[model samples]
Target: MEHAGKHALVTGGGSGIGKGIALALAHAGAEVTITGRRADTLATAAALHPRLNALEMDVTDEASVREGIAAAAALRGPVRICVANAGIAEGGPFAQTTLADWRHMMATNLDGAFLTFQAALATLGDDDAARMIVVSSIAGVRGLKNAIPYTVTKHGVIGLIRGLSEEYMRRPITFNALCPGYVDTAIVRGQLPGLMRRFDVDEQGAIDIIAKGNRHRRLLQVDETTGAAMWLCSDAARSVNGQTIEISGGQV
Candidate 1:
């Protein structure tokens, strides 16, 4: 219960890595607010634990983010642990990637994180020590073929965290990014169909095909990444700021 009485906000908490972190925080005694675009999904997640509160929030919409976060703070308290974990992954040839495709990734991956952290920071008090974490990808640190736009957005989030951590150096807040390899989440599951068609394989075969993207030749679990996120929010990590935690089962 290291986080007892602290208020935490996690964007995209309805499923995948986001849900894993939200559940971990709630179990650790934080009053966690789990937000997403789908109310039903959020509601189902909240029912898993009494400490979790469901909030309908669209991170890409300015008014929605500001007002949603304000309401969350009012209910749970100031967000002492903000995890901007909502993001979308898309890939295509750089030559064929349309402006709309690029902007869509930017809106959800980069802009969404910007809004979530900014709104959550507004709720903090001067004396409150807080942790603001951005969930990025290994692609952030290196380029990934056929996913130029996604790679750019992930890199952008890391930059955002670095700059924020420096700006708040004198404050009680720390900013950091978690860059995990291809995580086994809904996002990965959704890729199975596309991969199956491309490789003429079944579900498991498709998974194996994509797992090669990781240096370890396997997909990392959602909880594996959540462990790093939970640790970052703990008091011990107060000094670990403006850093990137890479969890790819090997050196990136």
Candidate 2:
């Protein structure tokens, strides 16, 4: 129970990698608040674990984020660990991507993290050790072929963490980003059918296409990314800050 009595907040915690990380934190004994836009989903996720609490939050809206975090913190305690995991992964050719699409990605992926980190920091004590983990992607570090919007938003998240890390260099809080490639999540599963339709291939072929995004040509289970998140929130990583821990099979 290393995280006993700690209040951990995870955005987008209804499913996929976010759900995995929330469960990990709860298992480690933290009072977990899982936030998402869907109340039903949040409730369902919360039902799965006694330590998990559900909060309906639209991270894209600054007011919603601020209000949601404040409410959660008031109910549990100061947010000692925050997982900014809410994001959308949409891919299209640059010429086909619209301004609305770009803005949507930026709103949820970039602005959401900024608002979440700021609000969580406000609840943290000056002398307390805290963790802010932004769930970025390998695309954050390097460009992807047709995911321009996702790439840009992820890069922005890395920049957010880097800037915050430097600004709080002397503080007890640590900022970091987790860059995972092709994790086996609902987001990736949603792409399989599209890939099949686009390439006229079978399910395996579509899966292989997504898996090839990683250097090892395999899809990572959500647990793999969760492990990295757990480490970032652990005491062992006290000295690790302003770092992007890449979970791709190999270097991009």
Candidate 3:
């Protein structure tokens, strides 16, 4: 449950689940590197903890990921924990989904995980132990109406982790995915206005509508997901590989 001197890297660590995980790891005494496209946001999150360091990197860009990880490793050490949590969730009618929207989702969610894992793995030596966690969604395990592209990307990341776990079965690294349901995140909050407009309801009404999607009919706290990520990083989960830890209220 403790990581005294480990080096952990979390993408999209500026806010929400990613930020929560980064802060938790830092509190556990790990030298944490948090990366995001926004420097200001990253800095704000990093400032919350002395163990947290901010790194500006776009998960969608290959060169950025490679260089950013290398720089982080140089400063902190080889990454022992890598969390690929950078993604966007945009819901729209399937018929109205353009190719551009599909590509953007694919790039940020699926491709971002691929690049982050590849680059972080490169920092580890043959004998080094590492944990790779992907922050997918509940939509990954089932079809989500009106969110075809987002669901596809989430599912794609789950596949990426599964294949990677098998491919590196003999290695000291473990690959896993965390599929969480609707949480009280900025992403969820951002969708509230749209939901209100579409449903002709108030803010609280929109939130209630979204909460109904979860089996518990509630918006989960960020700590719920962060706790799972912290457990996967612990020694107890060393054998937990090629698995998906669903954080939804119940099975989808």
Candidate 4:
């Protein structure tokens, strides 16, 4: 167990990329606390493995994150690894996007990461080794058409990681980001209906349009991203701080 006895916290750990990362860490012998707004989802994920625990938390809410992560640390010990993976992905034309949608995106993707990292760092001291990973997207590094709000929030997260990494340069803590493209997840499935309607095509046709966005013209599995996350947490990657690990089938 490479991570035996380590305490890892994964936000939005109930499903999608978060779930995969949580399971991987648990298998590596970390005491993982998976948090999400859905109690049922958290409970279900916890049921899947003995090392995974459930914590009901909303990243957008400062109080919930502060208290919930504190509680998690109390139960599982100080959080040595924090994965800010909870996010909402919705996209539309910039002019057509409402202010409310923009706020919602920023609240969850940008502000949420801010609060998550802030609270998680509170559980660690200067001498304690830790890793903080922000689950950004390919959009973070490059702009995506018709996804202004989502793109903006993602870019903001990358900025957050870069700044944090510099601030903590002398400390044992490291900050990094993972940017993946077109992962095979519930989030991607949900986009199919919209794509079909917008493109006037069948499901497979819409999927083809989406898959082409990846360099290899195929969907990425959750484990592909999980492996990169696991590497970020390893001692071998100690100097790889403030870097963006892009997994888009090829270089973006």
Candidates 1 and 2 compared: the better one by TM-score is 2
Q: 1-252 in candidate 1: lDDT tens per residue?
A: 999999999999989999999999999999999989999999999999999999898888999999999998998899999999988888889999999999999999999999998899899888889999999999999999999999999999999999999899999899999999988988899999988998899999998988888888999999999999988998889899999999998889
TM-scores for all predictions: 0.98, 0.98, 0.98, 0.98
Model 2 segments more than 4 A misplaced: none
Q: Mind giving the per-residue lDDT tens digits that candidate 4 earns over 159-248?
A: 999999999999999999999999999999998998899999998898889999899999899999999999999988989899999999
Q: Alpha-carbon error at 54 in model 1, in Å?
A: 0.8
In candidate 3, stretches whose alpha carbon ends up further than 4 angstroms from where it belongs are none
Better of 1 and 3 by lDDT: 3
lDDT string for model 2 (9-101, tens) is 999999999999999999999999999999999999999889999999999999999998999999999999999999998888999999999
Candidate 3 C-alpha lDDT tens digits along 146-240 = 99999999999999999999999999899999999999998899999988999999999999999998899999999999999999998899999
Window of ten residues with lowest summed lDDT in model 2? 120-129
Q: List all candidate RMSDs to the true structure.
A: 0.9, 0.8, 0.9, 1.0
| Candidate 2 collision pairs | none
Candidate 4: C-alpha lDDT: 0.94
